[model samples]
Target: MVKRKSPLRKFLFYFGLVIIASIILIPFYYMLIVSFHADYDPYKTSFNNLTLRNYAEIFGLIQSTEEAFFGDEITKRNLESINTKLERLKSISASKESYLTYVEETLIPEKEKELRNMIELIMDFSGLTPENREEYLQNAMKIGTKEYNEIMENAQIILSEGDITLLNDLYYFLNNYKSEEFLDKELAKVKEQINELEEQKQKIIAEKATEFPFLKYMKNSLMFAGLGALFSLIFAMLGGYAISRLRFRGKGMLQRSVLVVYLFGGTVIMVPLYQMAVKLGILSTPFGAGVYLIIVYIIQTLPVSLYMLGNYFRTIPYSIEEAAIIDGCTRMQTILKIIIPLSAPAIVTVYIYAFMIGWNEYLFASAFLGLKSYKDLFTLPIGLNAFSQSAHSVWGRLMAASLVSAVPIIIIFSLMEKYLTAGFTAGGVKE
Candidate 1:
C-alpha cells in the first residue's frame, strides 16, 4: 500500500489556505462593491444603485453629476435672484399702474435687456416666429391660449434638439410675466441669459473634467519604472554572467555585498537617500526626479535580479559556452547568442520583478518627489495618495482608480507568466 500523509494535516492545510485567502479577498471584494456604487452603504445596495459610471468617469467617458450641478449653480442662483426681486417688486407696488410703470422702467428694460443680447445669438435656432411668438411691449395680456400653446410646443422641440438653454429661457419667460407683441423679444432675451449660464457651466466642466493626474502620473511611472527595469535587467544579466562565468578578484565579496542594500529597510536608509538626493539636486526638477526615481528603482531591482539570474545562470552547463568559444564567438557574443536566449525565462522573471518594485513603490518615491511644486511628476502611487486625501468625497472614483492602476501589473503578469515555470528545471540544472 502507498503511504499517505495524515488526513488531519491535509484538513488543517486547506483550512489555513481558506482563511488566508479570505483575509486577502475580503477587502478586494469590498473595494469592487464600493467602485460600482458611488453612494455605497454596507447595509443597503444589494440589488439597486449599481452602476458603471465610476469606471466611465475615471476613463473620461462621462462627466460627474456633482460637477455638472455646481457648474449650473451660478445661473440657477442668478435666476432665483431675478425671480425674488420680481416677486418682491410685485408685492410692494401700490396698484397696477405703479406695478406696470416700475416693471417697464426697472425690471424689463434694465434687468431683462442684458439677457436679451444673449438670446439673439441663437434666435434662428429657437424655432419661434411672428405668428406664434408674443410681441413684448404692445399689450401685456395678448399671450393668449394659442400663443401659450405654440410656445410650449416649440419648447419641447428645442428640448428634444438638446437646446436646454433655449428651453429654459422659454420656461422663464412664460412663468414670469403676462405678455403681448413685445413678449417675443422679451422671451428671446431670457434665452440669452440662460444660454450664458449654460456656457459658464460648460466652461467649468471643461476645465475640471479631464484625464489629468491619472494619465500624467501613469506616464511618469511608466517612463521611470520602464527605464529602471530595462537597465536593471541589462546590468543584472551582465553582472550575473560575470560572477557565474569569470574568475575575478573579490568575486565572493562582490556577490555577498550586492544584496546588502536589502538589509537596511527603506525607512532605515530613507533619510540618508533623501539627503543624498538633496545634495545631488536630483529633486530639483521633473527630469531630475525621473532620473533619481529610475536610479532608485534600479537599486531596488538589481540585487534580487543579480541573485536570481546569477544562480539560474549557474544551472546552465559550462560546455555549451566552451563550444561557443571554439566557434570563435567572443565572450559578449556568447552571452548574447547562447546564454541570453537560453536564460529567456529567468530574464523575463527578473524584469517583471523589477517592474513591480518600481510600479508599486511608494516610500522612496514619496520621500524624494513629494514636494508640492513637483506634483506634475507624481507617480501612480503618489497620485493615488493625493487622490485619496482630496476634499472631494468621491470614494467610488478612488476605488475605481485604485483598481484601474492595478491593471498594468495584471497585464504584465499575464503576458509574461508563461516564461516563469521552466527556468532551471530544463536549463541543465547542476551544482
Candidate 2:
C-alpha cells in the first residue's frame, strides 16, 4: 500500500510545478507578443504598432506595406519610366492650343521657311515647268489627290535612292498629322502600366526571387525532421528490441557503444562528419544535408530510445512471448503483435524526442549545410539566423518567423503529450 502525502507536501509540489511551468512558458509568451509587433524591443512593450503584416509577408500573402511597396526599387524603376514619358508629353504639349497661339507668329514663319526649302528640293527632283511647279506647291500645302500621290511617289523614290535623312523628315511630318492621337495613345499605355504597378502595391507580389524562399525552407525543414523521426524510430525499435531480449556475444559492449555515441557532443564530431559528407559528395545538396542531419539525429536519439524501450520491454513478462510462440507465432510476429502494442507510449515519446532533435538542430545544420549558396535548402533555424543577420533586421519579423516555425513542434508535442506522460509514469504487467 502507498502512503498518502500531507497537505503541505502537496502544496509545495503544485507550487514547484507552477514555478517550473512559468519558467518554460514566459519566453514563449514573449515570442508570441513580439510576433504581432511591427517594431518592438523588449524594453519598450508599449503595444503601439502591433500587426499581422509580418506573418503576411512571410507567407507571401502581401508584398509589403503600402509605403514600403512604393519605396521598393522596382517601383522606382517604374516611376523613372513614367517620368520619361511625362517629360516627352510636356515637350509635345508646347504645340497644343494653350501654348501654340502665343508662339504661332514665330512658329508659322519657321514652318514656312522649312516648307519653302522642301518645295525647292522637290522642284529640283521633279524638274517641272513653271505652271506645274505652282500647281505642285499649292497641292503640297493643301494635300489634294494629285499632291498626295506625287509626294508618296517622290518619298518612295527618295527612300529607294538611300536618302534616309530627307525621307525620315518627310515621314515624321506625315506621321504626326494626327499628333495628339498618336502621343495620347503612347502616353496612355505607359500610364496604364504605372497604374497596374500601383494596384500591385495593394496585393502580394513575390516575384523577387532573391528576397526570401519561405516555402522552400518550410518544406525542407518538414521533410528533414519527418524523415529523421521515421528512420530513427525504425532503427531504435529494432536496436532496443535486440538489446532488451535477444541473446548475443558482446551485446553489453554494443549497448555501451550506443551510450558513448549518444554522449558524444556535436562539436567533437562536426569535422569528421563534414569530411565524410564531402567524400560522399552530399555537401550543399538538400538530400546530402538532410541525410547527414538525419543520421546525426538518429545517433543522438537512438541511445535514449534504446534505454527507454529496453526498460519498458523488460516489464513485459517473457511468458507473454512464450504464449504467442505456443500459438505458432514466429519471433518477428510475436515482437510485432505483442511487444509493439505494449510499447506504444514509449515509442511515441522517442519519436517526438527524435523529431524535436532533428527540427531544432542548428549548429551542425549551419556548419555543414553550406547555407550561403544553398539557402533554399535551409531549415527554419538556419533561415531564421540568415534573416536576423540581414541588413534590414526587423525583430518583429524575426519573432513572427520564429513563432511560425515552432508551431509544428508544439503541435507534435501536444498530440503526443499523454503518451509521453504515460511512458514516464506507467509500468507494465505487475502481479
Q: Considering every candidate listed, which one attains the maximal lDDT?
A: 1
Total backbone clashes of model 2? 0
Would you estimate the TM-scores of all the predictions? 0.63, 0.61
lDDT of 1 by residue, 1-431 (tens): 98787999999989999999999999788788888876433234343488897787677666544324322344345545655654554453545555455556676655455444333323346644464333521222223545445544555554455555654554465446555444545545545655565665555455456424577788888887888999999999999999998999989987876547656667887789889988888788878877887888887778777878998899999999999899999999999999999988788887877777788888888887886357777888988787776544367777888888887787777786666444334432111
The parts of candidate 2 lying over 4 Å away from their true place are: 1-26, 39-47, 64-210, 213-215, 414-431
Prediction RMSDs, each to the true structure: 15.5, 11.3
Candidate 2's TM-score? 0.61
Q: What number of backbone clashes does candidate 1 have, counting pairs of residues 3 or more apart or in separate chains?
A: 12
Model 2, 200-251: lDDT tens per residue? 5333333432355566778887877778778878887787788888899988
Best by TM-score: 1
